[model samples]
Target: MLGTASPTRAWLLVEEPGPWGAGGVPESRLGPEVTESLRRTASALSARLLLVRRPGQAREDDGVRTLFRVTCTRGRERVLVRTCAAADVAAAAADDDGWTERPGNLLLVCTHGRKDWCCALRGRPVAQALAALAPDDVWECSHLGGDRFAASVLTLPTGWTYGRVDATDAVDLVAATAAGRVLPALARGRCSEAMVAQAADVHARLALGVDDVAALRPVAARRDGEDEALWHVDLADAPASAAPGGVLRVTVRRTAGSEAALLTCGAAQEQHPPAWDLVALVARQLPAG
Candidate 1:
């Protein structure tokens, strides 16, 4: 799951109190017109729109819903919140004036069982466990991709994602996130970056023993030569003994899997997913002016 984080940097999480269908928002109670409108608005903003519901049986849509708009841009990360009648969700999301900036973060657990059984079976427990620790900050959300990586969790504003997480791991992750640090062991990648940059960022962090969320930053990424499968990524490290210039470069290669495998329980046929490999890592210091 190294570079598998969803590629969107912006998200519009609309509270639906679902039992969402396999298609997520489009198949929910919000009918085609509203869903289409929302899809258009989200697409215009380059945002991912997902349905969210509170954990447990007590959750019921009371006509009014809370919405969260989050952008995970590296230096300008922010979360905005607003409450509106369920019918006005699309309008509210498109309106920029009424939103208020919110502090803290959100933990979205993928539990859309209709999309994939592994998600509901494995993700529910993680969501419940997380809600027990921070009720207001956790929600059971629709499909987040990578179904085989069940019990997947996505932290908002930061866009840090984790997979194969259990109840214990959930607690630790919440604590780590609250403390503004990333638990690298279970991390998939950050959604704010491209796949190559995500893989390189994870590698750089572990290589430098850096866990602080703001320590290692992706400076630039580019395809290597004419090969689409090869990439070179540069990250700005916090001033450290390893590099006086605080720069690290990582090279990565992408390759298709050798064999097809059952990736999701809902899949009709086996499929092969691509893999990313680290080619080289170098820390270089720049000349002083």
Candidate 2:
């Protein structure tokens, strides 16, 4: 209300969906789960104000000088509302609320990079749909470092990356993420600091082990669901032993399966264990990402 901004905040209103509001924009669905999650999160955070809309509203600056505007529809009636940003337009979806809800960096990126009819493809639809639904969260990017993946929306708070998303599932994705629920099909996975720095060596390829290396790939991992249990891994490597001169010949493995488990294995590799760290011993016989 006084500073350079108005504390990024969002105001959400529950409404039914209908046809295009005005500009012939498409429609966005507010699936039951998505809607419930949004409400739950908004209530938990005590959100005072939020912009609400249906899909198909043009997500852009229609010329509101002060706050950010993300429009949507209530069955053909074009609805335009102001975003949280009290100063900068980019803070539209934020700046007003107490900053409690997660997905910290809520970014709606448009992956439709190439300036051609293709730009209007899925990327544009995603851009417009998200813009209409959560327009303030819209972002213009050349690329998110992937091919055919036009936009990359980075939900603040958690750095989960989703690719190939479009207008249709925008609401579902946003709502699911806000609820801290894992959208397995949507996550691009997260790699840890240890995993990023690992370039371990293969010490000895043991034959008398409980498991053997088969196929390996660089994977981002983490523990989830009932298995507070770490990931279970299956690895294979060439038969090897300590170097004739002295050193052992082992292969470092790239991991898959669970993230927490992979991290556990990666960490174990550091402790030069005689046999305690099974992951390190097993990893020594694989590849890297």
Q: Pick the candidate with the highest lDDT.
A: 1
**Can you tell me which runs of candidate 1 are displaced by over 4 Å?**
24-26, 226-228, 258-260, 287-289
lDDT of 2 by residue, 26-135 (tens): 22243435434544654554432222232343445343322222211111111233433212333333334433322223444433223322323555567666666565
Question: Tens digits of per-residue lDDT for model 1 on 133-203?
Answer: 99999999998998888989999899999888998886789898999998877878999989888888887
lDDT by candidate, in order shown: 0.85, 0.33
Instruction: Estimate TM-scores for all models.
Output: 0.93, 0.33
- Angstrom error of the Cα, residue 176, model 1: value is 0.9
Cα error, residue 199 of model 2, in Å, equals 16
- Clashing residue pairs in candidate 1 (N, C-alpha, C atoms within 3 angstroms): none
